[model samples]
Target: MKLIFGIGLFLSLSLLCYAQEIYKESMSLMGSDFEITVVSENEQAGAQYIQIAVDEIKRIEKLISSWDQSSQTSEINRNAGIKPIIVDRELYNLIERSIAISKITDGAFDITYASMDKLWKFDGSMTSLPTPEEVSQSVARVGYEKITLNEDEQSVFLKQPQMKIGFGAIGKGYAADKAKEKLMQLGVKGGIINASGDLTVWGSQPSGKAWQVAITNPMDKNHAFTKLPIMHGAVVTSGNYEKRITLEGKTFTHIIDPRTGYPSQGILSVTIFSEKGELADALATSVFVMGIETGIDRINQLPNVECIIVDDSGKIFTSKNIRINNNEN
Candidate 1:
């Protein structure tokens, strides 16, 4: 009887250990691929959780997508310089936060950048650069200060008629954050939401280890320069390796600096890790526009945020708090 009782206890422990399994689902949403992974005891539960995440992301896209004429974001852009449009609390808050990020980054990350004219093309068909006057005119209406928010009325107004706001940079990350939050609320133990490359994770893998993320090398797209062990939080990478144009023997990236109305130069890619995907996404773009020196300085001032910047010459610059493992250089 004693031997039988011991065997039963051991079998119970084994069953418990086998119950923890990780499941994943990937699909296209918000004009990008969204991958959701969750740990569960069975496949059904995992699928259900992933579905919930998918539904939540779709809901957010409907609310914030500028392409959707009925979306509040579209309404705000349409009425730019015309009238203040009342918006849902969620969108109002997002715009408010975007403005705050613009202030923090000293206009390096501006939602009003949407107002800039597309003077530069990166499709390899461009033979010459735009004239200096044309470049200057392109960003005439781009200014963060032009965005006005009314807290009492929950309205957003663009002071200039031609000014606009778009979330091409931060929307995916924000959706990732919201999806993660919703999953956590649904009692998910562990999961990852990867919106295009803006990834956010919570909890650990089924093996009880942290999630591992690889930072792709801008120069060599197939290889990763470093890998990071992330237990929680978010990671976002902004790079111009794939989209760029060369004119007069100078190569310009697709990422434009709104302040100067020109493509940002000297940085191939910038990756940022932060507590929220929204912050990480915006900062990655901001750093690319800010350049290495000012960008690294700004990141160093923020606690719990780290960055890795690869210059145009393949030089790597990291924030003071970051320690890279298996650095290629």
Candidate 2:
């Protein structure tokens, strides 16, 4: 008999309503549901594999969660500005990659954005815009260049006294990448690890079909505007609609522009597809802050990275290989 065999007819008939031979499990992690799925000849086997992947994802989240206050990442943050603190290999690499993207985007994508003070409230309580000095002071602590990385010692340092770093934006993608890696290491041929909306997948369905993913319409969250195929990589979407606070007559998204110390405007959503989830996650926010023209230009320069951008007017733009297949036609 094969190591994994197809479901018997009796078992298949019991769960006939399921459209695909897929098994899925949803777990709570990183403040959202982390879902994993495996498609195989047998639903039972697929469920077992998905559980394994979800377990590994939960394990990683516990280690790296900054919100936990007891996690390794939080420890590094607590010691910030005092001395260089060594971190795990995973966090060290993540910081390295984030700095590289920050350099490439001219500081538009910065992990040190946490250094900004909790000023410029966007709740519907303010009547006047913040003064230029207030804006400047808020971002005085948010320069990625001030973050020193000692590669030989694998330590990270924030030069300013009040400076801090957080991984709220890129943590999901890193978790997705780790989950996918763990599943593949377990000898699973194909699966998807979705950390919130940051997801990665590889191989083919047991039926040899491509994995399909839909891009949401920013104006209408209920409907998907496009469906794209995922052969062997990752996809991540960031939207201004998700987190926002309104003040007076204006609405400010939670995504801060590191340069201005204010919320970004114009773009509504950004979706990135790349070979690595980490790059896709970081690039999605970077492109949103950079706006369309510069965003497209930056993504075009990177290897194995593609982006789909929706502006405030709902205008859609895409990179070379990203096809926005409107399901209407």
Using TM-score as the measure, the top candidate is 1
Instruction: List clashing residue pairs in candidate 1.
Output: 81-161
Question: How do the residues 1-329 of candidate 1 rate in per-residue lDDT, one tens digit apiece?
Answer: 99999999999987876687999988999899888999888999899989988988889999988899989889888988789999999999999999999998999999889888878888878888889999788788998898889999999999987788899889989999999999899888788998887789899987888999999998898999888899899999998888977778887889989899888888998999999999999999999888899999999999899999998878888999887764557
Which window of 10 residues has the lowest lDDT sum in candidate 2? Answer: 1-10
lDDT, candidates in the order shown: 0.89, 0.81
RMSD of each: 2.4, 4.8
Output the lDDT of residue 138, model 1.
73
RMSD of 2: 4.8
Clashing residue pairs in candidate 2, if any? none
Model 1 lowest lDDT segment of ten: 320-329
Candidate number achieving the greatest lDDT relative to the actual structure: 1
- Candidate 2 residue lDDT tens string, 1-329: 34234556546654543344767777877788778877655777777787777677677777777677877777767877788888887778888888888999999999888878776554655667777798899798898898898989998888888787887777778878887887788777677888776779887676667888888899899998878778799989999886777666778887789888888999999999899887888889999889899999999999889998888887888887776565222
